[model samples]
Target chain A: MTDPARAALAITHEPEGGLVLVLRGELDLAGLPGLAPALDDVFALPRQPVVLALDDLTFLDSTGVSLLIRIANHFGTVRTRGAAEPVRRVLEVLGLAGRFGLGEG
Target chain B: MVTSAPRRLSILVGVVLLLITAALSFLAWLAHAESEENLLRRQLAQVGTLLGSQATVLQVQLADIGQVAVATDGNPSAFAAFADRQLTETGQSLSLWRVDGDDMEQVALQGVPPLLPDGGADRLTELEPDGRLVMFGILPGEPRRLAYGLMPGEDNTDFVVYGEAPLAPNGRVEPAEGSPLAGLDLGLYLGEDAAPEQLLQATAPVPIEGRTETTSVPFGNSTLTIVGASQGPLTGIQSAALPWVVLGVGGLLALGGAATFEFVSRRRAEAERLAAENDRLYRQQRGIAGTLQHALLPAVPELPGLEVAARYVAGEDELQVGGDWFDVIGRGPGSCVFVVGDISGRGLPAATTMAALRFAVRAYLAEGHTIEDVLARLRGLLDIETDHQFATVLLGDLDVPAGRLRLVSAGHFPPALLADGEVMLVDCPVGTPVGVSPSVADSAVTVPVTSAATMLAFTDGAVERRGETIDTGLDRLRTAAGGVVSRPLDGMLDDLLGALVSPGNKDDTVLLGVRWG
Candidate 1:
């Protein structure tokens, strides 16, 4: 059986110099390997706005939130949208929603 | 109790099994040894029987030669022809002697020398009527021989006939080549005496050790003793070694099995010890968490014309101290601010966050802030302090004398109202959980509280389970609260909690009841 805690990352480059990364499934310690390469690819791109779409994410642990914060720091114009309730809760609790431009319509 | 009874029983069984295995091996070995000894004895007896029969055959042949000599009747030519014929017919040598005035002359001889020496003839002359003498002796150039001499009837004038046959080295009548007793040491003694002097022939000169079997054969005037000795004990290679091998292997297998059992049991005992230690630590931490939760929760205040009661029950999982909590602060003489909130996580971190939010709400209320203003400020507090911790809270301002209640829900379960024997949940506008966003606005709903009406507020733990929907738990809470609204506030809470809370509920629960009188 596949591990429920592992996540899958899909990154798409928009024509407007923006990258949309969609994170699906649980983003726990088991998911870190799949996330690391995608994150590295996002960092390697030329300076552009990155949008993290977390609508499909089922769960997010503290380590995953730390990684998201790191991603935001890498690309200064990063915005997060479509966060599930749990992800939104964590972002709000850590006070990162406003800093990362999360929950914007 | 700490000493395992099963382990003790297993050890006892192992020891018993080992002893049984050892005993069975020894018995098997013993049986094989006994059978081997019996085989040896039987072999010795067989050799003895064979030797006895060979001696009988030799004696009979000698007697026949003696009878032939008697028939010759002292005639020199007749005796010569008779002796030569006997020598050729039997495989023995023969001689004829004539007795005359204390002297014996060998008148006829064929294939053998005279039975007596020239000077020893006087001894034979003394022979009485039909007298016989059997002797075993070696000729000068021949192998060992058995000779028999017989005198014909009482007249001293008749001749004596002597017949002699060659014997094997061991004195056996048969040749050693085809003899069953070939490989064994044997001795033949004449005249029933087995002493060294009487031994006529022997294969080996050494005295036989251990046991020997003897058979006796009666010759004409002497008894022949056939003594047979085995080469060694009758035990084959497989028979001798099989018993020892079984015993050794059985012992090793028993030891290995017992050792394996001991190793497994020791590991089980160690695992049990670790589990027990972990359980003890979990309970201790649960106790500390419970204490912290109780210390941080405020007691229901005594507001006039209102009966206020609140209960906080920790979750069944002793290690998981959850974040469910409640607080009641008297806002003014006839008004009170009551709050019930649940943090999203468990253990110390959740408990800490619950305490922070609870106290912050009280501080904001004491400063005369509205319910929405207090929630807004709580959001700010959670956002600044906690990294991944959030709470859902239902805050209310109860004005008892005016019979009015104002409620603000921040992603929390709405309170249920029981009035006029009807129970219904108070649906209010829900903002995102306090930590989600600082800009999210919270709106309030004001409802009228009739006389003898009850308001029930609780965390989701009071309703939610592993697989069931949240609505099912809410419906159950409504049914329970509606049925017990007429009872005293404390008893009502007891009944409601008993009906709403399930066994093995993994989350903490906080229930608050405000009965307007």
Candidate 2:
């Protein structure tokens, strides 16, 4: 278990014409507000393939998954890289692994 | 906790303050009394000094005249001139007397003629040799007088310098305005005792009275007794009223302190009473919520050839009951339609919404609609915007003898299937939670199981927790169900609940289980 308020994020430009957003720490209801400004920065970009880096992520809930679904519906092509086993399991059980291109539960 | 506790505390504070005020006032009064006595004593001493000073002035004047009498060898012209200066007041006299054996003669006189009778001259002859100075009271007459005689101190001096002065008007010697004894009622008397006839001078009439003090000062061959009393307080007005001031101010402070103490104490008691009342009301509302929650729940159906048991746990937090329920309807022999749904929020609104949806499910299922249709129909029952709530449900049409289950999920978790001592969480296609929009469940996922398989469907309360993943909880449930799968359905469900429900879980949990019998 982790506190979502201390959640951290980093942005990197990719040479393949996309933006990579890295997220760390527990992402929960209490931690969502801290990411708003950063999310706004991403929202300003036009139709770029967004890559999510979730290797260091420790926790995920239905609300957090709903947000990921919104991101998938927003971008041209959204891809998740190095997702942890627990995060993949929730996405798989909610039948969204195919949508986000995360293989297996 | 006693009803009178605050009142008793106030009384205690008041008594303490009153005692303190009394003690302070008493001390101030004591100081006042002591200084008053000293003041009276000091005034009486001044009166004695006044009388003695007058006597000294007379002796000094007479002694000078005696020197003149000896130097002039009893010359009348020189004596008259010097003696006239000594008679500074009206009705006064000075005389030169020659004393011989058993006789006396007035050689010279000045000012008023002597008012003494024949015995007065004889009394001067009685003055012995070496007499310093002598003063005697003359017998009572109009405007009484005192006579003084001084034989010259030198040897062989037969001439005596004598003087007489009548008392002032009414025998009252009014002290000068700024004198130390100005504000005093005073009396001076010859000799120690204050005899009426012996009164020499007085400010007050006749006898001095009212808080009087007496003292004595040396006079020629005798003493003058001085009696005095103060006309007003010796100390200033503030000091005179000091004791009353202390009492008045201290009394006010005492009452203020007591009143403040009573007010605070009563407030604390009132606050405590309100807190207890809130606690009682909270418990009462929780009790009512529990009763209402149970009354709205549907009893599990008794289907032939199937063993079923369901459990519901109310959350221990908030006064309102959570909205989570499970229902099982028997369709035919060894067949049943079971539905498990969870509302997103709580209280009467969530509970009413849950009730409406649960009833709708029962109605549609009785109409021989498929499990997918039951889930799709719920979308029309509620809208998240109007009701401020959403619901997720797991609906299943189970074939107990056939060991087959058809499941449809609306944003709900798949049920766990246990058979031959193996546990598996079914992978039903998840859809949007009901109430988000008017949508249809277009897919129904069917999974086959062993004849002895038992299935358990539950709400998210069984697995979801903050700061962790839901899969961790799902794993725990699977492990627990594998261990208890061989037991009777009711006993197995109890074991699973005890093992999987964490002590920190405050969310409501609903566990619906069905086993092939």
Task: Give lDDT: candidate 1, residue B363.
Answer: 84
lDDT of 2 by residue, A1-105 (tens): 234366667777678756888878766544666777877876676776789889987866544664565566557577898888778766665555666776543
RMSD of each: 8.3, 6.4
Candidate 2 residue-wise lDDT, B155-187, digit = tens:
888888788788865569888999876998878
Q: Which residue pairs does candidate 2 place in steric collision?
A: none
Candidate 2, residue B210: how far the Cα is off, in Å: 8.5
For model 2, state the Cα shift of residue B455 in Å.
Answer: 3.8
- Using DockQ as the measure, which candidate wins? 2
Candidate 1 structure quality by residue, lDDT tens digits, B308-423: 89888887844768888898887665678888898766677777888889889878887989999998889887751345666778899888678788998776877898889899
The weakest ten consecutive residues by lDDT in model 1 chain B span B133-142
Q: Please, what is the whole-model Cα lDDT of each candidate in the order they appear? A: 0.70, 0.78
Docking class of 2: incorrect
- What candidate 2 gets wrong by more than 4 Å, as runs, is A1-105, B1-52, B69-83, B91-174, B183-294, B299-307, B317-321, B382-388, B417-424, B435-442, B447-454, B479-504
Clashes of each: 0, 0
